[model samples]
Target: MLIISPQTCTEGFAYDRGSRRCIDEDECRTQPDVCRGDMQCVNQNGGYLCLPRRLYDQPYRSEIPARPEATAQCLLGYTPAEDGSCDDIDECETNSHHCNPTQVCINTAGGYTCSCTEGYWLIGGQCQDIDECRYGYCQQLCANVPGSYSCSCNPGFILNPDSRTCQDVDECEDEPCTHGCFNTYGSFMCNCDEGFELASDGTSCIDLDECSFSEFLCQHRCVNTPGSFSCVCPPGYYVYEDGRSCEDINECDTGNNTCTTAQVCFNFQGGNTCLDALQCHSPYVEVSDNQCMCSAENPACRDKPFTILYRHMDLSSGRSVPADIFQMQATTRYPGAFYIFQIKSGNEGREFYMRQTSNVSATLVLSRPIKGPRELVLDLEMVTVNNVINFRGSSIIRLTVFVSEHPF
Candidate 1:
């Protein structure tokens, strides 16, 4: 025998024999008159709703009229209490207000209001974020946050305690520069010491290359140190006390010359030379270390010099014109005597001139500018005449001049 159990259905549901299941009943269609004249029915899965007909026609009304079918009368956002009196509904507590997330909801008598929260403002019926930065809150830099602003400063400045202005940061206190530092309005500057210069990084100091800046700063070579510069001369020279000029070392007087006992050491600008003692030819006698004398009685020395002397001198090139270089004076000054001076030879360039300075002395003057390394041999002759006694004597000096290559 084949038998089937009878199925049971809950309220608002009916058993279907064709599909073998229980289906929900359409209450709105099954009972068209279930609602009142001013109300309509809406079907749900397990129940039905009787809403005002006006709610279907005007869904966005600002004011909702009280329902005549309710036990107590109340406006929108209000509910009836146990005493049958309308009470204010807390839309915020109930989470039923249509306010923005950033707005606050407050309940009133039979209604509710929406307002912007902190850090925001209500504008044109909408909540807007307030720009605190637009109010000039920060002096240097301002960063606008959601509802406020943050104050900042520039690189070399610091924000003040009030957070409205910027103050200069004293980088000098931190010793940012190797030598010195200066603080300005909003920044700091680095400075170097006497002979140093600021580096590219603006925080360090480096040696100033004075030599590279000007070649004439030193006479010979310029040496740069940490904070100073030095003018250096060669092995046989020395620097002037108050300047960068190089002077002759005078190795002969300094006892640094490599000359034998029989040789004489002559010092020049940067070097020394050794020479044999002066040699007197025939008819002449050695009167001094560098002088030779000849007697008037010797016929071979009639036209020749009665006395001959040798002299050596060193000079820097490009000397000033008309400079008094050498002076010749008679050893004995005799009353009523006359003397004359002249350059016998070695004036090919006419670079020298002589002027009588006194009755017994004469001076040799340079007439033109001459550059060297060069050597000039000048034969200067001085003639002395004593007409009262009929005496005439002449002296010759062989002057050898060495001009250095440099002026200093």
Candidate 2:
């Protein structure tokens, strides 16, 4: 019904040069630029058709034309494949993940997942070591290991079967110390015995100098040695039974003095002294080197009885001494008792008189006088009025009788 030139036909239609009429035109073959970039052009009767291109696969949409000066890019976490489709990246397996070595990696939608392994936890996106010891799991200390935890004990302790408790070890069994060995967990120590001390080496023993201090024990001097000391006395003294005490030597009894024959050596504490021996004068007779009696002056002195000697018997080294040594004070040891004193034996029986009474103390008294120097021996005993067995204490006494000076 209408005749139109090729240029006058609607878009995508062409004028048939042979029929002299308007007709469909293959615009897709003739003008490739006529369709949109994201669409394909198809030939139709008297026109052309445009359709969207097929998408490659998932994560990819239908073809979309990019704006000016912009490129077509896939969404975040997706990349283009060989077929121009978008595919999610497996960062977990592709070595593109940010997970720590101690963490586990998992692929997620559009991203990756990171999780910490055992004995570790996430902190600031990184796996941090877990401190199991902080929770009191171990008695002393704890350490973190890969995928697990470990327990430890302090020095001088040993881990128990539970791995959480600690126990002390016995180092003394091996005698590591010279005297005593103390064992602590993970360590051992040594100690010295009595009178000794630890050395600078920490394990050896050394002697202790006890005399270094100001404790003076010796009578004259103190001699110090390893772990012990001794007391020393002067030349005239000797060490007593007790190691630290000193006693004097009896020079007279031991015959160690320098006295002449005419000099008599008398013993005293700490030393000895000599005295001159006297000779009897006229009208006086020499009883011995040390004494004389005036038997010639009185002439009746020999007629005097020996009973007079007990009155002034001497118990001292000096002649004509008093008899105070024969006296004793009896103390009452029992609750109720009487003290009695008597002579048990004598050189001449009944020659001396002794009195016994129900008193706490008694003594033998000499009321008579002697004509010359004499020696007397006696034994005494003490008893309770009830006759209970009580041994008499023992002591020695020397006695002498002297006629008055020149028998005055």
Candidate 3:
């Protein structure tokens, strides 16, 4: 070796010429402040230098500086642990935020945000009601609720049960014709017009007849009655009761029998009949009675014991009076006087003679005689006298007759 100086060879501590101080070479282990803040110290020949620390704390952080190898343990907003490491802060669990009271906080990767519930909106970071009615969201009338709204209709209207839409009500459909119910916007009305009367049910209208007042319907004279009238006619005119119309009566044409024998009949108004008498013809001889007779030798009497008669000879000829009460008589009897008589004209011919009479006292009864003068024939034959009879003989014999004119 080389000879060392006596000053530097006292111990391991020595004085260097560059620093000119006694130095302990192992002092870095006991006093680390001897290194620079950014440098590391190592056992070089005999001195040390400064080195940087492994990690550094942030500027505003309150924790100790960290090591690079422990990056996973560093908490962003928290202080370091006693072990010089970091842990999680968990701000979501702490409930510290500026969100609205009615909002919800949702934790994100690095922070949190706020939001409202259903039917609400976030306005300026606060919850507000979404007015669904204002923007026509409701189909009908709208009602507002907390943070929401509903739909409904006003009075006098109804919402359709299916569609939820407002509609007008028809009140007239239920009670139709209620005084003529009229439907309007949301209601109905009731009334009637003039010249009409409302019925008891207030639905129908009725009419009144003005013709029941007076008898203005008839012409000359009027008789007013219930629902009808009549007209009257003057005298000499009779109204037919069937239709009440007037007509004339002809009294003269109606035959009212008022007449006597041998009379002419006439008619008048109100049914009257009249009569006048007739005359008889002249006689061949005047007899003791009111009739005309003939003697036995008279040319009108064809033979002796003479007689005269008159009668109706035809069936069509009507009858005259006293049909069955006449006789011819002789006071002095002649024994065998044969007499024959024949009717000239009228119904009397069938009723006058009887077959049992053939003597002088035989009789002929007259039924009805002809209206004018009529002639008849009789013949008599005198065989012999009964005894010596007196020959005093009157020239004429008379008879009286009564008469009725009609056949009935």
**How much RMSD separates candidate 3 from the native structure?**
38.4
Clashing pairs in 1: none
Of the candidates numbered 1 and 2, which has the greater lDDT value? 1
**Can you write out model 1's per-residue Cα lDDT over 191-302, one digit (the tens) per residue?**
8888887888998888888888899899889998778889998776788995698878888998988899999998888777897998999999999999999988889888
Query: lDDT (CA) for every model shown?
Result: 0.78, 0.58, 0.45
Count steric clashes of candidate 1.
Answer: 0
Best by lDDT: 1
| lDDT for predicted candidate 1 compared with the true structure | 0.78
Can you give the lDDT of residue 253 in candidate 3?
41
lDDT (10s digit) by residue, model 3, range 17-49: 665544445656766666776655543223333
Runs of candidate 1 exceeding 4 Å displacement: 1-88, 93-103, 108-113, 122-128, 137-140, 143-188, 193-196, 199-207, 225-227, 332-337, 386-392
TM-score of 1: 0.65
